[model samples]
Target: MARVHAPRLIPDPCSSAAPRRPLGNDDAAAALGPHPGWARLPLVVLATMATVIASQSVISGAFSAARQAERLGYLPHMTVRHTGQHEEGQIYIPSVNWALFIGVLVLLVVFRSSERLAIAYGLGVTGTFLLTTTLFLVYAHIKLRWPLWRLIALGTVLYVVEGLFFAANTVKLFHGGWLPLAIAGIMGASMLTWRKGRRIVMAYQSDVEGPLTDFIRRARNGHLNEVPGTAVYLHPNTVPTPLALSENARFNRVIHEKVFIVRTVPANVPHVAPQDTVTVDRTGADSDHITQLTLHYGFLDDPDVPAGPRIARDHGVDIDPDTARYFVSELTLLDAGRYRGMRKPFTLLFMAMSHNAAVPADYYRLPRERTVMIGAQLEL
Candidate 1:
């Protein structure tokens, strides 16, 4: 039997006349042979599988980053689900996943093909590369102890190359690059608004709340009603007087027998052992009965406020289960207009976020029946 040769459908890379270019589906199929059905099937399946795996990896990374940002106080908190028993990094944020799903659908519908989407993808990749390269320069120079000349040399080359790539991608801004830029803008604006709102709110509270030591002194002298039971007030810092406690005293004129001002600190690591995460400091005189509790959590850990009793007991202050009450301060953004740092549109956005953010009782896993929310109005 004589063999018949099939036509060369795809260009050979080794040939001088065949210029390198992205191969189309048709080219791939044709390259297989005249009867290319079976041969091309595996190739198509492999390519699809690779794409799916890459996409899944990217989505996982996005979830991890979003959760970290939320923990770091840059973004609002979302419910996180741990998929693995021992893997702290295996987290799923429903909101982020849904948003990404919708985003992917919109992109697919709008772009229709990978050719058009590549511009936007390229823009995102280049922008991230530039940002990472910039960070690397700083880390290399300061932390890695690279020589000044070496640092400058490495940074300049990386920056020049990445900057050029970013600049080249900018040409596609109107075509498809606008998508990532718009997303980036929204994220940047959100992060900025949160940071500014937090700063302004904290400063306002600090100015109004007064010193913790002074409050403890006053409380000891019988300034407020010494109510039965332990009162746990969650504060951002170790401020002796928490906003919740101050408000309770000013309005209600009441204080619990043993007052605990607790603050949960987030560590950069994945998981902090429970035993090593709690610190208790007994403040004021023996008669005052004021204690400060600081709980440390890994960036991935869910904060548990109900553990306050256990933590207190570990430090020798036994909290009565029946009498304990958790107090949280809720912010009401008064439409009295904007304040310093946060202005107009962004301020409104921040206010909306603040209004919708998860309540302390829910986010910190406090006992709902024993939690008290005291609302305070703020201008910003």
Candidate 2:
């Protein structure tokens, strides 16, 4: 009690001050200045990472792992998956582990190739990075309403940083980088070819509906031509309309010649044997040329499936859809400015090769022919 009283009377050091806690929000903001900027930055970094990973997934999903590894000299050709007896494209594809596995194996077996792998994959990543920068600049202006000057400054800085990576990746070109570059080229061209082919198909469909339908009606009725034994309407993908057959009947102007609307779609599953099909009657077979309607299927999924009669027959629509007399109305561009870029100047020249290469057949499952070439140029 005495001690307590003494304490009560005794000194308080500077008004009973207590130990201060650790520096937190205010300290950090003071240290960083403009605190929310820190939070915003993590979001931006996360978005960028998502884009890069997604890009890798798309590219890897399309190509095999071993073949992709080959670009950087990871494995010998013998180890790669080869195309089966009937397949056309490259065979050895990649999975997620193949990417890292090869890179690791390369480091263990042959140190030099591993370094090249690092450099080679870097280009694909950097190429996309540059694309991201370019696209994001356009996006920021629209999304954030950033002023022109700020956008330019930010864009310029991004370009410089990303450009450094691009330049660094280019160093690999001398050491087997060209192989991946060529693969990239093939992928880009394939995409363009599919687009051009679709354009022609749409144009042909437009003419088929009205005036073309009328012409067919007269012909079928015998004002213009006699009835053929079979009118097979061929389409590259699944779901061909009996339009061609419909037109044929319209020209005939009488039902009784059977009509066959056949489609050759490609399936995604690899285990699926080449010959797969679904047959159906379009509008209950309004007395057209179709003895049987067979929908052919290709090995690759429908989208990647090329327009070819051979691929079509894999699914069982093995009929001759194109003849010397049969017209394939086609419209394509040698220079469709749609797929434009600095890294892709070759696009301008390659589009010509793609357009001029004899028109691909609407897939219907047969040994495809390469002769028919009908080129149509639409209004620019």
Candidate 3:
């Protein structure tokens, strides 16, 4: 349909009487009108509405993508608000929305016209197409185990088409095409740095936290004074003892009478089954009153720390949510003066991202009044 009408919508440069103004969507709308009269007004209005709907869809998609990235550990935790009760994908990310708004404002001020902006848009779209095609081909080959000849034939055809599209846009590199590429580069760098930094920080934390089983055994042996309340430690994994729990035992020299080490695991699916949400490990809970609770949440599911206890009760683990005091770790990154693994600038970027990330209490929906943050410093 577009190919059939494009010639009428676009002016021919070879024509001597063609207008000097740059062609755009407005021109296309005008072409769709019956005549240069009242018909033009309605067409323009319709075009405007269509553009608005498209932009809104893009913004909503961005919110979902950002939320998923944060959940999957590709990005820093952001404030995600579910806007729809029945739809798990209906979410709003204020940070992403604001960033997009600012980016659009800057682009409008700099480019000033659709003709100039098209260069960057074309590059971004074509780049995405090329990458998506490559990824699809790779997935088919590796996962589906496509025969070598079939893989080569399909890949050759797709790559040639995508390569041509990408190569056509590369000529506009200096003329605003660099904007999208630069943005992609920065975002990719940030995601990679955050993932790597998280691993390094977690390794350091695990080393410092020692072993969870050992700590539980020591507490069971009456090595520390027993307090009379339930303490819930929110941790990323069940492998290492939570830094908050270890820190509390170290500084206060007291262990809670009943302790629950809770770890919220982000599953690969969109929504985990309600029945499979909470699992309790009572390896030593019956004797020592120390239990290990694992909460499974999908990328779209909310990680409510307070609700974990209620869910655990269904699994035969009794926990009082109202009186449980939640403990979380607040990590402060110290200067890594001579770190060799990650560059200094990337380290600084990671620290800045971590500093701005949503607080654990808010992210996990823990009770603010009963939540306690244990500060810990990590150098490198």
Candidate 4:
């Protein structure tokens, strides 16, 4: 069967009518029948459907990767909409979707023919295979505790094969392979810059906010004027006092009667157990009325701010969800001329990314009406 189909599926180089370009799957499909002309339309339709399915998978994978990167602090927070009610992984990221759409348009305009596009696709696939194999080997050694000799042997064999393919693809770098490499480089640099910038900003904010325990001590010492109503401040961690809480106290000269410092922690697992969702600590005595709520969410879990306090209620924390006010800090980046933390270019990129990132209220599904944004400036 293979011998009989070879002539039709693959163009013969010796044949005078052989096409200049290599035969693709579409061509092979069309050539399968006795009459190629009659099978062309059906092959086109099938190819179109296959392309749609492939594109859908790529888009979905991009969304999932973007979300995971954001959660892992490699990328800035973006608006994530959960598309599936039961499946947490089924998410739609508008930013990623639009970016991919624009990229596709640009690539289509730049590379008009599939022949040229194939060069970039070859490099992309081989590069992906090489990196994935490398990562898997590392994971096997560290996480799976594979023997060093076995790992080295397997890795050497895999790397040699993939390296040869990658090297072959690199020969076409100037032709079309440079496109994917350029895109990967840009994305990698952006993610690294964002991660480093965030660390610098976080360190600065930590210094400004001070220790949570010290702030609690101050409140216990009657330093803060008590006001009526419940206030929930969303923080990244329980170590430092939330910037919103500090700013509110500094500007208004008062703190809420019942203050809830909520921190949503991302768990390692896909979905945290329902019973282990929330952990509430009253901070000090019952008279203090200052509670530290830690909401544990898996990477796939939705970090809903408004629902956090309600979840705490089930965990024996007295929180009034109806009348609660949410407080979040809005950070404005200022480039310090003599700043040594990050490079000037990266600082600018980080600032722009930060400006475009989704606000906490919208990202966490907090009620806009009840949410208060306390502006804080950070010099980088």
Better of 3 and 4 by TM-score: 4
Comparing 1 with 2 on lDDT, the higher-scoring candidate is 1
Candidate 1, residues 11-57, lDDT tens digits: the string is 77799878877889889968986774676889989999999999999
What's each prediction's TM-score? 0.83, 0.37, 0.87, 0.88
Per-residue CA lDDT of model 2 for 157-239, tens digit only, reads 98999899889878778775564576677656544544554454455555544443453344446654444433444443333
lDDT of 4 by residue, 1-380 (tens): 45554444776788988767788888996788556578789999999999999999999899989999999999999998888888867888989999998999999999999999999999999999998998998899889999999998998999999999999999999999999889999899999999998888888889899998888788888888998999999888788999999888878879899999988888889988878888888787888888888889899888877777887787777888889999997779887774547778888898989988987888999988999999688777
TM-score of 1: 0.83
Among the numbered candidates, top lDDT falls to: 4
Ranking by TM-score: 4, 3, 1, 2
Give per-residue CA lDDT, model 3, range 190-252, as digits (tens): 999999999888888889998888988888788889889999998888877889988998899
TM-score of candidate 3 against the unseen true structure: 0.87
Among all windows of 10 consecutive residues in model 2, the one with the lowest summed lDDT is: 70-79
Measured on C-alpha atoms, candidate 4 has an lDDT of 0.88
lDDT of 4 at 155: 89
Output the better candidate (1/3) by lDDT: 3
Give me the displacement of residue 233 in model 2, in angstroms.
4.2
Which candidate should be chosen as best, given TM-score against the real structure? 4
Question: RMSD for each model, in Å, please?
Answer: 7.3, 19.0, 8.9, 8.3
Global lDDT of each model? 0.82, 0.49, 0.86, 0.88
Off by over 4 Å in 3: 1-35, 283-285, 336-340
